[model samples]
Target chain A: MLEARDLACLRGERVVFAGLSFRLEPGGALLLVGANGAGKSTLLRLLAGLLRPEAGALLWDGADALADRAAHAARIRYLSHQDALKPALTARENLHFFAQLWGGEVAAALDALDLLPLAELPARVLSSGQKRRLALARLGLSDPARRAPLWLLDEPTVGLDAASVGKLGALLARHRAAGGMVLAATHLPLPMPGAGELRL
Target chain B: MALLARELRLALRHPADTLAAVLFFVLVAALFPFGVGPAPETLARLAPGALLAAALLAALLPLDRLFGADAEDGTLDQLLLSGLAPPAVALAKAAAHWLTTGLPLLLATPVAAAMLNLPVEAWGAAMAALGLAAGFLSLLGTAGAALTLGARRGGVLLPLLVLPLAIPAVIFGAAGIEAAASGLEARPYLLLLAALLAAALPLAPLAAGAALRVE
Candidate 1:
């Protein structure tokens, strides 16, 4: 179980959010909803251990999660707005690099996003939506043998098409079926079903 | 090693950044002979300082983009969350910088020194001293790059931050070349250059890694 108690955040001199609390159980999915200036991205970053809370405690399985940051990080798969690709590298080479860093089957991950046909093309040549799909392909690269239990996604479906959205929905369903948890912040509809909503 | 391999692959595909730095190094050293009269003795006397200074400046040219590109593309965030220590990431960058930038500079050092009329006796010492100096510069550059990552006018700020710290490398490098030219022992100066590298090998990555984690 993941739990947050009275979390607060500060951006520059302004307070983004304060006195926030939530709980996420095993196999649970939480969708974050808020207006443009709301703290959805900040909350996802905090949960991913990218940003520190100004005040509050985060607990995982009834223990302090932030105390051992590397351990916490190992359990997370985060996808931000940017595609995070090298323009000079081919799509296959790009996915292979990440696979080498975090154990995964590269070909399978590429296939998951239907990227095998364009695998030889340099990322720079891919369209914006294709780049987003390529980024989503990373989600499938997590080793099923030792899957990262928690996924923190920020605007994951931004540039994807209708067909790509269906593929992503299947991926999310499989993750949840395997007892994984997802915390996503998005303005669009996601594939998650019966998910709890958190508004900022 | 994955990060290092990825960095090398990226560099190989473009090849422009590496080529630009080396060309700049040779060109800068070549300019010195023209600015000063081409008298052989004058060229010989000025070669050590001119060559070393040019190499140092050339190394500085690529430091601004060392971390800037990764930050802009969001690759840095993935690296931070990869579960590898941040120091290890910074170390890989330093290694790649040396391999692509420093190694090329060292390979071209003899040609630059030759053009400057440096004696054959000093060539070996110049290469040795420059090898050490280049590695030291890579480390210092990594730290400076990380510190100035998100700052305004970072390209302008990088040399201002790294050049002062690089004085020792030039001092020892030039002295080693001068010693060899005069038939004196150059080992002492070369060792000093190595010592500076030894000190920076551990400290620079640590500082750069800490800076990376701040955001």
Candidate 2:
């Protein structure tokens, strides 16, 4: 459902990755692997429509994603290292805000991640690990009008503990079960079975 | 609609951030009397201009933070990708800023002016002018804030970028009040300030949204 042809990305004056091409069908996952500063985050942002490719085109279902930016934005959820949590808001409020933005079910996302217990606490008081879990819960929300979305995640498991990592795998599995796709850039293996890898 | 609501919720949750700008407005206007001395005539003459300038500067303090906070935490990217038009996001931010900072400054303008021995007759025009001027400052300031997002030393650079653009508001704002104080028709000055607002209402958000794309 997604395709990139000779995608050339640059950082400042340097061309981090060039002549890159990939295609992923619905329910597929692409694991990106490369050395530091090899443009994993850049690749995710490029696909998420946040950054334009220095050269190349991104196609969603045979249509130019760049040309139809709003459609591309609607169909994907890009999660970078930054959690995007408002520090002053409670955990549930933070999730609810994003859920409302994305047109997803707030309660379902919370239930999926077992975050109900910590919902009332302000995000500033949450530990890094809990914060990551909260972010993961945000990623779990689904728009019922559409099917589950395409995910462009940058090191999503960085602050997750083993249990949270396992929960993440389960979440991915559920998303895939519902015919969603993921393109995750990670240093550590995501334990996503049947996933294909692309080294930058 | 949702973006505006979310901004209001966040602002309500963190009232102190908005309060700081309002307090800055009060403090800056308060200090003008002390600096200019106890002469009521001199203070009255300075009140309209000083209050308008104070409100403009105070608005600047919170204006930069409108987008800066979200940009830092990656919320701006998410907002962009939330399928809402980028221009609408800029509009929501500009509106929230007015609600929090401009509205408070307008409400306090009477008390603030009174402290400087402002005549009761001029309060209506002064408040009306300050209200409209504050709205214009917010729209212009937000465009600057969005333009400077992620730039080095953006806070220091913001005023230099926006204040020049807002000079019309400052001039018309004080002029309207002064004209009214003399029992003259203030419509010409008020009309000019209103024209500024009407022009900026559509253009500023578009400029700020375009700036977001470049950033």
Candidate 3:
């Protein structure tokens, strides 16, 4: 389980959100919804242990998340707004590089994302939607079945088409049904059923 | 092992980059004789400095991509998220940079030496000095690459940041060669290069790791 208690996040001098608290149990899907400057990404970064909270604490299970960062990272995957694909490398090369880092199967993940045809093409030649899908494929492959239990996504569906968005919704639903947790920050209404919404 | 393999793979894929640096080293070494009038005594006297400078410039050419691409592509975040510590990652990056850039420059040094009219007897010592100096420069370059990450005009900024730091390596490298030519011991100059590498090996990575955390 993941829980944030009295979490206050400050971006520069402006307070993004203060005294914000939420808990996500196993098999829970919490949708983070807010305005343009609602600090949704900041919140997700904090949960991922990428940024420190200005006030309050984030706990995973019974331990402080920040205190055991490596342990936290081993079980959590955070996909940010930037997909972070290297344009000089091919889609398959990128997946292979990341798979080596996270220790997973690259071919299976590429097949799952329907990217085998474009796998040999350089990322620079990939369309924006295709690039996003490739990035998602990397994440799916890297997320170890036993280790990755929590996923934090920031605007994952921004450039995605309707079909890709629907595919994402189904993927999230399946992940949740398997006792994993997802905290997605999206402006659009999610298509998944039984997803809890938190508007910032 | 994995990081080294990745660096080698990246370098191999871009054969033009490695070839260009080697070509630059050879071309730059050849230019000195034309500029200074091809008198053997004068060429031999100026050989050490000229060869060292060419080697430094050639090694520095491809360093901009050392961490720049990974940082931009989000591979840096994944590296940070890996179980390895930031310092370990920095060390691995420095090693990779040396393997790709410095090693090639070291291999091309013999050709540059011949072009500069260096004495045949001094070849071995010159190569050894350059090997040590290149290692130090690679570490320093990694710090420069890290500092310039995400900055506007980073390509221009990297050389500015690294050139000054490279001065020590240049000095030691040239001095060691001159000492060898004069029949004097080159140990003192070699020791200075070794000292620089020792200090930079630990400090460069810490600076790089901190730079990665910068917003």
Candidate 4:
């Protein structure tokens, strides 16, 4: 389980959000909704241990996760606006490189996102939606030992088509069913059951 | 180790970026004769300074792209969070930068040295100094590149930040070559270059890695 307490974020000189607190249990989903610049992304980054909050503690089952970032990062996948891909390499190569780095199941990641056909295509030629899916494919790269990993996704549905969106919803459902937890920031409504909803 | 291989692979995909730095190094060295009015006596006299300064400038040319490309594309952040030590990533990047840019400069130096009328005896010393200077510059440059990773006008800011740090290497390199030209021992200056390399090897990566961690 992941937990945030009395969280606060300051971007530049402005306070984006403050006094935010939440808990995510096994098989749970937390949906964050906000207008543009409402600090949804900021909060997710904090949860992913990407951004340090001005005031708060991120606890993993009562212990501070911040104190051990490498171990924490190994358990979570943070998907943001950028896909972290090389345009010159094909999709498979990109995924393969990440798997080598992160210890993921590459073939299943592609299958989960239905990206096998586009696997050999260079990322430069991929459409925006395809690129987004490719990024989503990373979530599938989790190791078999950790079938129920945490996902920190920011606007993950931005350019996804309807069919891809369904695939995403299904992926989430399956993941949550297996005791995985998700903390997502999105404007699009998703079919997530029994999810904790928060508006920043 | 994996990160270093990945960096090399990415660099391999963009051969043009690596070649551009080498071409710039050669072209700039080639122009020294015309700019300084090609008299062999004067060229030999000016060769040490010319070679060192040109190599310094050429090394600076690629520093901007060192972190800019990865930062823009978001791979830098992923690398930082990839469970490898941040310092390890920074060091791997420095290794790749040195291999692609610095090695080429070393290879081109012999021809440039000949063209500039450097004494035959000084050629070996010059190459040694330059080889050390290349490693030193790559080490120092990676820190500057990491410091300016996501800033606006990073290209313009890089040289201003790095050149001051490079003066020691420049001095030792040029002075060493000049010493060899006069039949003097260049060992002292070469030792200083090695010391600089030693100091920079451990520290540069730590500094660059810290800069990369700034969120």
Candidate 5:
């Protein structure tokens, strides 16, 4: 289980959030909901180990998660607002780089997002939604048998269409069913069923 | 390394950055002959200084893009999260920058040296010095790039940050070539250049990595 206790965060000089707490178990999903400046993204970043909490502790299986950040980072797949793509690289090459870094099947990840048809195209030419799908393809690169346990997504559905959103929902379901966890920050209704909500 | 391979592939696809630096190196050296009037003795005397300056300035051209592009597109985040220690990320970038930008500058040094009317005998010494100079600049530039990342007018700030630190390499590189040109042993100057590179090889990336780790 992953748990946060009395978490607090500061962005610039302002306190974005404080006294925040949440728990995520194996095969669980949590949706972070709040208006702009509500610290949803900040919370996701904090949980992902990208940002350090000003106060409180993050525990994984009852151990301090932040104590070994590389180990904590190894278990997460974070998708930020930007697509994290090289515009000059072809879509397959883009996914291939990440696959090489994290150990996954590039072709399978591409197919998961139905991106095989556009695999040869440069990412610069991809539509905004397609680019988002390519970024989403990274999550599918995880090995089914040795998946990273936690996924932290920020505005994951921002540019996705209904069809792609459904595809993503299936991906999320498979992950949760396999004892993986998800914490997605979104203003729009996601296809996650039986997921809990955390309003910042 | 995956990051190195990606950086090389990206460099190949967008060869403009590498090309512009090489072209600038040659052009800057070529301009010295025009401005100083093409007297062989005068040109030869100015060759070492002129060549070193052009190479350093050309290398500076690409420093701003070193970490800027990755940070802007969120690639730096993925790199940070890749579980590769942040120092390794900076080191890989420095290696790639040296291959694409630094190697090209070294290759073009001969043409620039010829344009400056440098003695044929000094060509070897000049190439050696330039090679070390390129490597030193690559490490220094990587650190500078990381430091200036996310800053306003980073382009303007990059040279200002890098050029001062580069003076030692410039002095050693030019002196090494001048020593060899006058039939003197250039070992001390060359060794100093190598010492600077050796120090930077570990420290520059460490500094760059620390800067990158800052949220």
Candidate 6:
């Protein structure tokens, strides 16, 4: 399980959010909804252990996430809005690179993302949606055996089309069914069954 | 090890950048004779300074892209979230920068040496000095790149931040060549370069890692 208690975030001199709290168990999905500048992305960063909370603790499986950072990191994967791809590299190369980092199956993940045909194409030639799809494919490639149970996605559906959204919904559902927890921050409504919503 | 492999693959995919730096080193070395007049004694005297300057410029040219792309595309954030220590990632990036830019420059110094009319006996000493100098510059450049991550005019700001730090490497490199040419031992200058690299190897990564966290 992942838990956030009394979470507070400050950007510059402005307080984005304070005293936020939530818990996500295995097989659970939580969608974070908020207005622009509501600190949704900041919250996601805190959950991913990319940013520290000002007045709270993020705990994973009863241990402080900061105390056992590597264990927590191995158990979670966070996908940000930017694709984080090197523009000069081919799709296959990018996947292969990240696959090596995460110790995943590169070929299978590319096949699953329908990126095989564009595998040799440099990411600079890919469209925005295509880049987003490629980034999502990284999540798939990160842990094929579903060992990383926590996924924090920030605006994952922003550039995805309806078809890709449906594909994502199915992927999230399968992930949840397999006892993985998902915390997605999105403006668009997700189609996952029994997914809880948290509006900031 | 994986980071090194990934960085190497990335470098291979963009051969233009590496090629450009090497070409620049040779081209800049070639220009020295034109500007200073081609007297053998004068050419030999100016050779070490010209080579050191060219090496420094070539090594610094691509540093902006070290963490710039990663920061812009959010890979830096993912890396921060990857559970790897910030210092480790910073070191990996520095190593990558050296492989792509520094290594090529080191390999190309022989050609640059010939272009600059460096004395035949000074070739080995010159190359040794440049190799150590490149390694030192690469580490400092990585830290500078990280420090200027999201600043306006970052590309312009990088050299300004890094060049002052590069002075020590240039001094030691040129001193080694001068020592070799003057029949003095080059060990002192070489030692200085190695010591600078040693200090930078640990400190640069820590500074770069802290900069990443701040961003």
- In terms of TM-score, which candidate is strongest? 1
Query: Tens-digit lDDT track for model 5 on A31-84?
Result: 999999899988988888888999999999999998887898889999998999
RMSD of 5: 1.2
> Looking at model 6 chain A, which ten-residue stretch has the lowest summed lDDT?
A138-147
What TM value does chain A in model 5 reach? 0.98
Higher-lDDT candidate of 4 and 5: 5
lDDT of 3 by residue, A47-152 (tens): 8888889999898886788887778878777788888787777899888876776767888778766788898998899999989888877656654555488888
Give the Å shift of residue A169 in candidate 6.
1.9
Which residue segments of model 3 deviate by more than 4 Å?
A142-145, B151-161, B184-188
- What is the C-alpha lDDT profile of model 4 across A54-116, one tens digit per residue? 988888999998888888877788887788888998899889888887777777889898999
Report the poorest 10 consecutive residues by lDDT, candidate 5 chain B. Answer: B74-83
Cα lDDT tens digits for candidate 2, A1-200: 89999999888889989999999988899999999988899899999988989998888888888898888887888887898899888898898877776657877787777778899999999998888788889887757777546988889999788877888898898888778899999999796999999998
Interface RMSD of 5: 0.8
lDDT of 1 at B151: 94
Each model's DockQ?
0.82, 0.74, 0.51, 0.67, 0.82, 0.65
Worst 10 residues of 1 chain B by lDDT: B28-37
Which stretches of model 1 miss by more than 4 angstroms? Answer: none
TM-score of each: 0.98, 0.97, 0.89, 0.95, 0.97, 0.92
What is the C-alpha local distance difference test score of each model? 0.92, 0.87, 0.82, 0.86, 0.92, 0.85
Misplaced by over 4 Å in model 5 are none
- Say which docking band candidate 1 falls in: high
- Model 2 C-alpha lDDT versus the unseen true structure: 0.87
List candidate 2 stretches off by more than 4 Å: none
lDDT of 1 by residue, B45-105 (tens): 9999998899999888889999999999888988898888989999999999999899999
Residue pairs in steric clash, candidate 1? none
lDDT of 2 at B106: 90
lDDT of candidate model 4 versus the reference = 0.86
What residue pairs are clashing in model 6? none
Which window of 10 residues has the lowest lDDT sum in candidate 5 chain A? Answer: A140-149
